[model samples]
Target: MISAPMLDHIVYAVPDLERGVNDIERQVRVRPVSGGTHAGGLTHNALLSLGAGSYLEIIAPVPGSEAPTGALPFGLETLTEPRLVTWAVAVDDIERRIEAARLAGYDPGERMAGGRDLPDGSRLTWQLAVRAEPAGDGIVPFLIHWLSEPHPSGTAPEGCQFVALRAEHPKPESVLRVLRALAVELDVNEGAAPRLIATLETPSGRVELS
Candidate 1:
């Protein structure tokens, strides 16, 4: 099995929010809960618990909302279908982790504040390091530090268990180097393209999402 002790969440970007949630329910037999709108009102999300500290985020542009001037987060503007865009790893001290990554010859990007109001009127806040480098086009995860109590996974819809996560890349060695710099390990294999593949044990059965 792939070892991912720090896996926080995996981002599954879709073109439509509700449809994505419905499709997931059909497959997993568990409905996700609305996580509420993100900052800037550009997009909203629904979430599903994938175990203790990890969850799956289904994000898309807000219905009937105006698209931003630039490309939407996670390149949602151009997506024709739902796909696994990227993932995040939880960190205790984000700044210190950033410095450690930099010293190891990889910049995981700069820290940026991000928050979203829950459907219950409470708020969730966190900081994440957004990387400019492709980092294997989402295979190499960014770092995140949640500032709020009760992580999202605690309240998200349950029934799904995260089994494992792995990556396929054209240059496995290069991606391995970056993973080492980030101080994480994932089963890497040679493939035509780079993709992050996650396995889940759902109510229906075993399912794989990439």
Candidate 2:
């Protein structure tokens, strides 16, 4: 059996990266840490530090975009508005994990290297596997492999820590089962309604559901 790994990051898809980051900062009261661009010029990402090698990621496409090189994969093509698209979990070996996913009946595609530019102009690169289908209401996490040296979140900004993460659905246990089947490691449970909730600790106070 495949064992789930640590919670890596959660992704939110927005129409615009700059605007999305600003909006989230306004709500959370902290500027999200920057993550660099992706391969297809789909610029993105702000990192919310969650203690213990985990974090929340908010992603958006760059404005005035060019057409992406390949066919749009699962969540990217279907997303109509800014919302939580998918979460990612870390693995010791991305290649091995991809094989495991394939054996378990998920056709995770080839590994792709992508990058994002930081606000300060520095760039960071990472790897990911795009799935053929949306993982059912964004509850299922896509796989990610961080290729950059030392991993992103190694030196997280001060005043941030991941407290707990929760996912809510009418069939909460079912959702957990899917996540488990995908080998994602986290403690997930039902919420008040059919929604996913993530809790964070910041300098200001505790924040929930980003």
Which digits, one per residue and each the tens of the lDDT, describe model 2 over residues 130-164? 66564546666777777675556665454567666
Scored by lDDT, model 2 comes in at 0.64
- TM for every model, in the order presented, reads 0.95, 0.76
User: Cα lDDT for residue 1, model 2?
Assistant: 11
Query: Residue-wise lDDT of candidate 1 within 25-51, one digit each (tens)?
Result: 998999999999985788899999998
Q: Score candidate 2 by TM-score against the native.
A: 0.76
Global lDDT of each model?
Answer: 0.88, 0.64
- Candidate 1 segments exceeding 4 Å error: none
Top TM-score hit: 1
Error of 1 at 93 (Å): 0.5
| Per-residue lDDT value at 147 in model 2 | 68
